[model samples]
Target: RVIPAQAALFAHVWLDPQNPPRAIMLQYYRDGWMHRAVWGDYDVIPWGAANTTERVHQGELPALGEWTRLEVPVEQLGLNTGDALTGFALTQFGGHVAWDQVSIRGTSDPANDPLRSFAAWWRSVAGKDTPGLSGELADLAKRGPQAEASVEARRRLLNHYLINVCADTQRSLAQPKAELARLQAERTALEASIPSTFVYRDLDQPRDAFVMLRGAYDKPGEGVQPAVPAVLPPLTATGANGRATRLDLARWLVAPEHPLTARVTVNRFWQQVFGTGLVKTSYDFGSQGEMPSHPELLDWLAIEFQRSGWDVKQLMRLLVTSNAFQQTSQVSPELLARDPENRWYARGPRLRLDAEQIRDNALFVSGLINLTMGGKGVKPYQPENIWEPVGFAGSNTRFYTQDHGDALYRRSIYTFIKRTAPAPFLSNFDAPNREQFCTRRERSNTPLQALQLMNDVQHVEAARELAARMLREGGDSAESRIAWAYRLLLTREPAAEELAIVQAQLTAHTNRYAADLAAAQQLIGNGESKPDATLPADTLASYTLVANMLLNLDETLTRN
Candidate 1:
């Protein structure tokens, strides 16, 4: 504490009965000289200076194990206002003692008149007039601290006064706070302006590793050295320190002699295109994993991948351009019965698109997808309050605010993902929760997936936009419009039967909407995109239903 003139130090201290302190010492600096004040029965050493002062207070020491008040005046310790109190030491001879509520205050009779003492202390500390403080103090003083209700009221007034004091302190600190915020923003900008990347750096001395017993960290069984698995090729590369480094491990992974790395890498890419890996268990390549369906083909592809210098684009081109990949997915019932999963390369890949692919496909066909390359994630429309149940009150994601304009139309890759409550449109299509690493996503067909495609605002808007495109670019006839939409969505001319079915539905919708113009307006206003003013509302709404039907078709959702 800083010394105050005519003030005394007060403390409540408890001394251990088994080991009471032999003495207590208060050391302070006065006029650039050190002085020590000793209490209790103990020897006082001059320490080659005349500044040492001793006071015998054996009678004042509290009874052992009982809390007692200890007071020392500044004058007795040769201290004046503004002098620095350097240190306070208890039981210098090694004893356990606890100190509490230590404070320095002027000599005021707090026991008899605490309200005035409290006001004085506030004035001394605050050093300025605070708004509402005087009224709160007066209200508290009037309560008198008597009955339980009065005590509660007085406590509330004190709390309110303290809150005001804190608010005043905050106001006083506003300039510094703004300066700190500006400095932090400047630091962040400086960091972002500098180009940086992470690189591995070896420590001067390698840390020793040990195998744990039963995987318990504390139960280390045996020391081990850096090496690859014994079943595969040994690690031959080493750093200048004659130890294997991360660089050496990296070189070993891509080395032609290594058997597993190239195979695993090729398998993962193959799985991305084929919907299943050759080994079935893409993440696990162990003894318990399924054997490769075509071992020779796997080896040949692995070698070819390594030979291409691991060019992913070249590998994708080779895979997609192969005869096996281009085969028709349709098969005879006998062939399907023999190989339901197509593990024998019996047919081309036929599977539903992933969640991101499904969303992006709709936007792409509707000409609403923003192809902007890099930025932070964007928020699109989702059901209201979906995140509230799973979100913490203090979390930034407690409220989901949908974005507008271009942000609403960015690619699905740039969609902001909240782990607790993922976008319902994506989750309903079996998107992973992202809580752990996923080598392969599980695909499931459910009614919710179809419902999302049919009713979601994004999809509905996409359909409306698609309908606008069909009306404007399609020939000026209903049959021509239906054929144009089928080609745009399915990438093929619709069969006569399929064309007739859609035309009939469009006619029925047009009749139904023509009778109810409000229904037509509501249907055309499903999305943020403005409807084309030139097109009739009933016509657009009729075509919107047709477009939604095409978007939800199995052929549109699957890659065959």
Candidate 2:
């Protein structure tokens, strides 16, 4: 009998096991040298079982004098297609186990063994070559599946395997037009036909248009139809109406040789990442627009982007990883004097995070940011009655009822936007009011922005929440708590100067809050979120003030 590793009693043997030892394993493997990946492990045996119990790991061999087979899935061992696999190992703790016809065999042929074939098929991207096993294997896999169906389906398609074939449906439905007509007639005679309402639906019909005079409802002008503008390139394709639709226009726009489309798209993407496009004016590439500084580089990028099937993410990766994108934005006095706009790209992008980011950062840093992406826009806490005077008659944008719980703390993008009163915090930070099509937001340095960051109810609440997190999660020392807050809010470690300033503020606020405990209570209990009652009122208020100072700093607002 083989003795298990009792030293590692109930050890999480995440690594490949040569012999079965009782342990619980999990996904997400990272051996320092290897890439962190979603790894599969052999099933966990019974917890803390000394003797080889009835509960065996998935690939465990049945203990007996007779020979037995153990099938170990390579994928489970975290190796994928085309990976170099070298050898295996055997371990016998009690004594040297007898080995006679011990051998490992793998084959390309599916018929040799069903279990091996199933594993091969599971890892592979393909339809089964064996017709008999195809349906049976798929059905059997349905009994107890671990992985996602879509994940497996994607693998099959990649390897040219058919996910499924409706052979029975095809055979049963086979019919010509005449056969179908006869069958329908027979069915009509046998069964009573349900009465249906007739209504006009879509058809290939000409839709005429009229030019309206003045924006009046009654005003109409000469009849017109779909026509391409004389200036731009002509549409390459159209429908039966001989009118170019949006789809046709879209198709032509992304066509390989389309000059403006790729250039325009790349330019916009460049602007977002680099804070300025090659052509300064992102919205326009007309004759009025600024000429590209690096025309050659822009063209090359556009061409490459087009070649990659207009892969936006790929293009973004290319831009962000480039040398030009990596430089520090710190400006020298000489360069500042010589190039006011920094058109030469002498430095990297140093931009103030726009309104949404400013508020979101406050929420995120404080550990109050709800990360549920893509849902109905919620009404977050706005200033008391800000929307009261801001609307039109018949507009349903009346109440400024604030959302409680998670909705109140959702990402700023999901904050409900009203036309008359756009989400104020973001709008104050130069986020567009949606009055017009703004390709690029114009930023204005104003006292209003600074004031909002400091005193806004949302921001104040975020500070308190952050203070709570720092109190709970931050380590023992004052320095550690301050450092934790700084790192959490800002992606980097705090500079000595920045750290000193925050530490000083924390000390000052701690003393101040201690002197006025009632004020501290009021300060920490500002918004919808509950106060962290476990924390002392003075400490909570002090941390809140420190967090507030951190959030308001120009360094915190700016994206490095």
The C-alpha TM-scores of every prediction are: 0.66, 0.59
When summed lDDT is taken over every stretch of 10 residues in candidate 2, the lowest stretch is 1-10
- Candidate 2 residues 132-250, lDDT tens each? 44453454444323444566664543233232322333354455535888999999977665546866533567566788888665787888765666687777656675666667777
Summarize candidate 1's per-residue lDDT along 376-405 as a digit string, tens digits. Answer: 899998889898888898989988888999
Native-to-model Cα distance after best TM-score fit, residue 217 in candidate 2, in Å: 12
> Which residue pairs show backbone clashes in model 1?
none
TM-score of 2: 0.59
Best by lDDT: 1
Clashing pairs in 2: 126-161, 127-161
lDDT at position 16, candidate 2:
24
Q: How many residue pairs clash in all the candidates, one count each? A: 0, 2
